[model samples]
Target: MRSSVRERETVARWDVARPSWPSRTAGVSLAGFRDSSAGPVDVPLVPHPAVTLVVEFGDGLFVVGDATGRQQRGSLVAGLAPGAVRMRGENVTCVEVRLSPVVAYAVLGVCPAELDRTVVALDDLWGRDLSRIREQLADAASWEDRFALTDSLLARRRETGPLVDPEVARVWDRIVISRGRVRIEDLADEVGWSRRLLWSRFRSQIGLPPKRAATLVRFRHAAHRLAAGDNAVRVAADCGYVDQSHLHREVVAFTGMTPSTLAGDPGLAVDDIAWAEPVAHLGVMRKT
Candidate 1:
């Protein structure tokens, strides 16, 4: 299904499309975005707890750059917690895929560690197949067709690629279930591994150390809460921060914006419609 979204105080507009049903492959969510504004678009890219792949089509200028000024145009893959990024373009059209880091290792055919905290050209990882997929997506007749094509490609890659350790996967699930409040030591104990081993294995397979992963997950939840109009003090307390300032530091660390500014960001304003199920499950507002 598709919907139109406009920022509350700006002229920026987007036609957002969501899949009719859940992806057949677990831990995968798809959304298609087409910029409909008359002028160029620029917005902060908020960090989330998953690996992101953007497949750009149409004759538009799409660019993603980091805080360091490194930039890539067209299709790209961003690993977990890529800090302080921004997306800019004109007439942008793309299918954005969010892959749970647990499943990302297999579907991407590489360890998440390789992509940790950075964005790389999809072509750099997928090679020529990236071109073929772009062609197919651009040729697809409708949003549903594009979703099906993307899902099929991911399912095939996941079936053939190496899976992460069961213990590590379990830990990731625990982290999400607890909303990142779970302790790494407790998780290691529950999984019957030494703290050191779990730390090394999770970092290698899931992209971030256990502690860092928890922090990112926590921040993801807190960010959505902020965007939903929750009071900062309440969000900070509920999300496990020591105080509001601690939450402030994390918000600035992740997006280079203070809480109030991020809460009103246009990119996050579209998140509720674009990622409805995940956002709902995390207990954030239905509209941001």
Candidate 2:
């Protein structure tokens, strides 16, 4: 009966309809993908800023490196393709979780808050069986369940506060209402703090700084558009990138491949990219 229950709890194993990994060069057995053009992942590792959740339906392992392509602590890294990041085990496994970039920053506050040189043990933050999350996430479940779990995990990290501070809350309100055209200078002025001072505090609290956060916001917005399957060049210009190369660079930073590669990856999952985005600079976004 438990076995039957488990079967119904998840989509039939064969029911997982995955995209054909467009590029054979992406490597390994590919088997899952997400439409990131929606918004930041309900999980965190934003492949395009909006693609927060990735579903994986297979196994593989990989080596991870930083923006410099060197292995280091706190550097962003991820599993290559279906099984990109390698561990000692001969076999690997997974399911999928849709997370938000904010979730990573909030949870990772216990460590150095930059993506450079960071080697994250997926089991340390979430459970070892990445697939278990999907089992618990069935249609028959309660909506509050996930949010409650998120809150509980967050409490462990001690990242809960004025999600939008009373002071910052007002500013967040202004920023959000502005519809993605906000500037760091204007926010600093509104918050009654110097741009530098505000940035310092922002980094401490948000894990990432403000300007980069703005990039995240823009990427999320643009990715949502990209999921619609528009021309890459046209989409790049509309997203405020200087050109498709700029878009390609960001895509590579988040995901280890290029935009020309298959956007619909049947094998990529959020846990795989536990820490792979390059910082713009030492204290900024990742550039590798």
The models' CA-based lDDT, in order, is 0.87, 0.39
Shift of residue 75 alpha carbon in model 2, Å: 18
lDDT score, candidate 1, position 280: 28
Q: What does the lDDT come to for candidate 2?
A: 0.39
lDDT per residue as tens, model 1, 257-279 = 99999998888876666787633
Cα lDDT tens digits for candidate 2, 70-176: 43221122321211121221122222233233343444343224432134545444453333543443321332343333334435543442232345435444543
Collision count for each candidate, in order: 0, 49
**Deviation of model 2 at 272, angstroms:** 17
Off by over 4 Å in 2: 1-119, 122-180, 267-288
Off by over 4 Å in 1: 1-12, 278-288
Task: Output the lDDT of residue 31, model 2.
Answer: 24
